[model samples]
Target: MSHASTAVQERPTPPGGPGAPESGLSSRSLPRLAPVGFAAVAIVLAVGLGLAAGWHSKVQWGMIAALFFLAISYAVTSVVENRRQAKDRLATSIVWVCFLIAVIPLVSLLWTTVSRGAERLDGYFLTHSMAGVLGSEASGGVYHALIGTLEQVGIATVISAPLGLLTAVYLVEYGKGSLAKAVTFFVDVMTGIPSIVAGLFILSIMLIFEIQPSGLMGALALTILMMPVVVRSTEEMLKLVPNELREASLALGIPKWRTILKVVLPTAIGGITTGVMLAIARIAGETAPIILLVFGSQLINANPFSGAQSSLPFYIYEQYKIGEAASYDRAWAAALVLIAFVMILNLVARGIARWKAPKTGR
Candidate 1:
C-alpha cells in the first residue's frame, strides 16, 4: 500500500506540464431527448419530400427517414462532441437500420399468413380429413397429415438423437487421430448437405430395392438431415464441460465412462435437449423428403412402415398447387398449423431445459 502511494506520487507529469486538466471524461454531450427530436424531424422531412415528389410508397418514406436520421445524428453529434463520438452514433444508427430491414419482412409474412389462415381454421377443419374433400369444396382438415408428420418426426428423432449423442460423446471423450478426424470431417459435410440430397439418396435406395413409398422412408431421410445438427450441438455442449470436473470425478475413483454418463452428461443435458428440439423443428417443416419418400395420401395411414402417408408440409404444397380458392384457404390454414407446431415444440424444449437445469445453492 505504501509503495503504491509512493509510486502514485512519483508519477511523471503530463507532457502539457503540471496542473493540466484531466481528459478522462467527455467535456460535451448531447441532450437525452436529442435522438427523439432528430427522428421526428427526419420523419417530417421524409414525408414532405415524398409528398413533393408525388410518391406513395411508405417503404420509400421510411428508408428516406432512416437516412435523414442517420445523417443528422452524425452531423449534430460531430458538432456537439467529437468525430469519434459521431462515428459511434453512426454505427449504432446503422445497426438499427439493419435490424429493421431484417424484421419487416418477417412481420409482413406473419401478418399475411394469420389473416388468410384465420378464415378456414376452426374445430371442423382441425378434426376432419381431406379424404373426400374436393379441391373446390374446402371442407376437409389436416388431421391425417398431422398424424403422419408426428409419426415420421418422432421416428426420426428416435433414430437420430441417441446416435448423435453417442457420436458426440466419442468425439469429446475418447476420440483421437485419423478416425476422429474423418468423423469430424463427415459431420461438417453432413451439416451443410441439402435436404433434397438426403431425399434423393433415399429415393435411389428405394428404387434399387423396388420398395413402395412410406412414412418410414421419409423418416429415414429426415434422420440423415437431423443427425449432424445433433452431433454439432451436442459436441459444443460437451466441450463446454470443464476438464477440472472430469479430473475430480476421476480422482474420486469413478471410471471415465461412468464419469461421463453422470457428471458430464447431466451438466450438459439442458443444451443437448434444446439442440435436439431445434433439429426436430428444422426437419418438421421439410416437404421435399416427404414428397420423395412418403408419396402424399388423402386418407390417413396409421402404419408408417408399409403405406403412403401425408405430412403437414406436403399437405400445404398439395393444397396450394390445386389452383382453387378453397385449396388456397386450406394451404394457408395448414401453414398456420405448421407454424404453431414448430412454436409449440420450441416452447416445450424451453420448458424441459428449465426443468432439467442443475440447481445451485443460494
Candidate 2:
C-alpha cells in the first residue's frame, strides 16, 4: 500500500468508532417514564411504611413519599447520566415538591369551606339579617355583616388611598433628609403592628373621648392597619415607573406637582388601585377591630357613625363561639361569604390592571 493508505490504517478508531465518548456520557439520558415510575414506587413504599408504623397522618406519609422520590430520582439520574444532570433533576424535583406542599393546605381549606358552607348559602342567606334569629336556629343571614363590612372597608379605603398615594409620591419624588427617613421607618414599623394593637390604639382614643363603639371606630382602626400596606405597595409601584417618564414631562415645562399628578399618578394608577383593593380586602376580614371597636351586634345598624355594627368576621366568631350545630353552619357560611368577597375584590383588581395597562400597540 502507498504511504497515505498506511497512515490511515495506522490511525486508531475514535473512542466509540466515530464522534463519540468512550463512556457514552453525551448519549445518556433518563428514561421518559423515570419520574412517574419513581414517584409510584416512592408512594407505595411510603404507604407501606406508614401502615406498618401505625402512623395515621397523611401529611407524614406525603412527606415520606416526597423524600423517597427525591432520593430515588437523584440516585437513578446520577447512575444513568452524570452528577450535573442528577443535580438539575434533583432541584426540579425539589421545586415540584415544594409547590405541592404549599398548595395542599390551600386546596384543603377551600374544599372544606365549600363543602360545609354550601348547605346554608342561598337567596335568603344573602338578603336577610340576623336581627331576630337565635344562635341555635338556622334562620339568620349575613346581610347585616356584609353591609357593615362594605361600609367600613369603603370608609377605610377612602381614608387610606389618598394618604398612602401622596405619601408614596413624596418619598419617591420630593422627600429628603430626616423627615423622609422617619416616615419610612414609621411606615415599616406600622406594617408589622398587629390588628388587635391597631384596634387597641383606636380604642384608647375612644376611651379618652368617651366615644361609643360603632362601625366608624372599626373603620378608623382598619385605616391604621391598612395605610402601611398601601404606602408600601404604592411606593414600590411608583419606584417601578421609569424615571424617563418624569424627565420627559419635566422637559415639557411641567411643574413638579403637575407632573406628578398628571404623569406619575396615571402611570401607576393600576397598581395603586390594586393595592388599595387588597388593603380593603385585608381589613374586611379583621375580627379583632370589629370586636373591639364595632362591638358586634345581631341587629342591622345602617349608620356606621352611630351604633354598634356587625361585620362578617365578627359574626363568624360569634356564631362559632356558640358551639352548636346551627351556629357552626352559620360560621362556615359566613366564612365562605368572606372568602368570596375577597376573591371578588381580587378579580376586580386584576380586571382594573388589565384595563388600565398602558396601550402598547397604539
Candidate 3:
C-alpha cells in the first residue's frame, strides 16, 4: 500500500452500467421505438379512415388503402431508424414513383393499341392493296401504302446516305477551311428548319421545272430533311473513332482516302449504321412532307418518278379523314403496323452493328 496503491483505491473503477466509466452506453442502444410506434399508429388511423369512408369494393378502395398503408409504414420506419437515411429513402421512393408514372402511360398506350390494332394486321392486310376499297365497307388492306413507303424511303436513303456520310467525313477529316465552317453553319440551320418548309422547297423546285408532285418529289423532300440528321449523327460517331487508328493507317503508307475506306469506315461502321437507321426512322414517320409533296393514291405505284403515291403515314391520315368507324379502326391498325416495322428495322440494324463491330479482344 504505497502512494500508487492509495491513488488506485481513491479513483476505483466504477461499476459497469449505463454510467460506467469503461462501459459507456452506446448511442444505438437507445430504443429505436419511434419508427415502429409511428407505423402502428398510421396503420390504425388508415383503417379507421377507410372504414369511415365506406370503401366496400375489394378492387378499388382496397388497393388504394393498401398502397397508402405501405407508403406510410415505410416512411415511419425510415424516420425512426435515422433522419438522414430516411431522407434518402424518401428521395428513392419519389424517384421510383416518377419512373412508374412515366412507364405506366407508355405501357397502357401500347396495350390499348395492340389490343385494338390486332384486328386489322392480318395476312390480307399485308398482301392486298386498298385500290378496291370504297363506300361504307372498309374493303381493302394497306399493302399499297406499305409498298410505297418502302420504295420511296428506300430511294431516299439511297440518295441521302452517301451524300450525308461523305459530307460528315469531309467535315471530320479534311474540311476545316472557311467553306467547311459555312457548310457546318448551314447544316445547323437546316436541322432547325420546319419539316413543312422542306416539303415546300421540294414542291417549289418541282413547279419551277413543270414537274408534278409525286413519290419522287416526296423522296427528295425527305432527303433534304434527313441529310442533316445523318450528317450530325455520323459526324459524332466518326469523331468517336480514335485518331490513333487513323495515324496507324497513315504510318502504313495508306493514302488518306484508302485509309478511310479500309480502316476508318470499318472501325466506325456500327455507329454509322445506327446513325443511318436513326435518320431513316426520323423521316419514315414524317407526315407533313410526304403529304405535301406526294399526294396519296390508293393504287400501288412502283415507280416513284412517274406519278402520285401513298405512304403508311399518309395512309393513316387518309383513313382517319374518311370519318367512318371502320376507317378509324384501320387507321389504328396502320399505326400499329408502322410502329412494328420501325421497331423491326431498329432491331435489325442493332443486330448487324453488334455482329460486325470490330473485335478488340484476341
- Model 3 clash pairs are none
Which runs in model 1 stand beyond 4 Å of their true positions? 1-25
lDDT of 2 by residue, 1-362 (tens): 69999999898866545555434554578788889999999999999999999999999999999999999999988887767788889999999899999999999999999999999999999998888888889798999998999999989998998999889989999899999999999999999999999999999999999999999999999999999999999999999999999999999999989988888888888898899888888888889989999998888889999999999999999999999999999899999999999999999998988898777796
- Between candidates 2 and 3, which one is better according to lDDT? 2
State the lDDT at 229 in candidate 1: 99
Model 2 ranges off by over 4 Å: 1-25, 31-33
Q: Estimated TM-score per prediction?
A: 0.90, 0.92, 0.79
Give lDDT for model 3: 0.81
lDDT of 1: 0.94
Q: What lDDT is reached at residue 290 by model 2?
A: 90
Give the C-alpha miss distance for residue 128 in model 2, angstroms: 1.7
Clashing pairs in 2: none
Per-residue C-alpha lDDT of model 3 across residues 139-198, encoded as one tens digit per residue: 678888898899888988999999999999999999987999999999999888888999
Candidate 2 colliding pairs, count: 0
- Comparing candidate 1 with candidate 3, which one achieves the higher lDDT? 1
For each of the candidates, the C-alpha root-mean-square deviation to the true structure, in angstroms, is: 5.8, 3.2, 6.7
Against the true structure, candidate 1 reaches a TM-score of 0.90
Best by lDDT, which number? 1
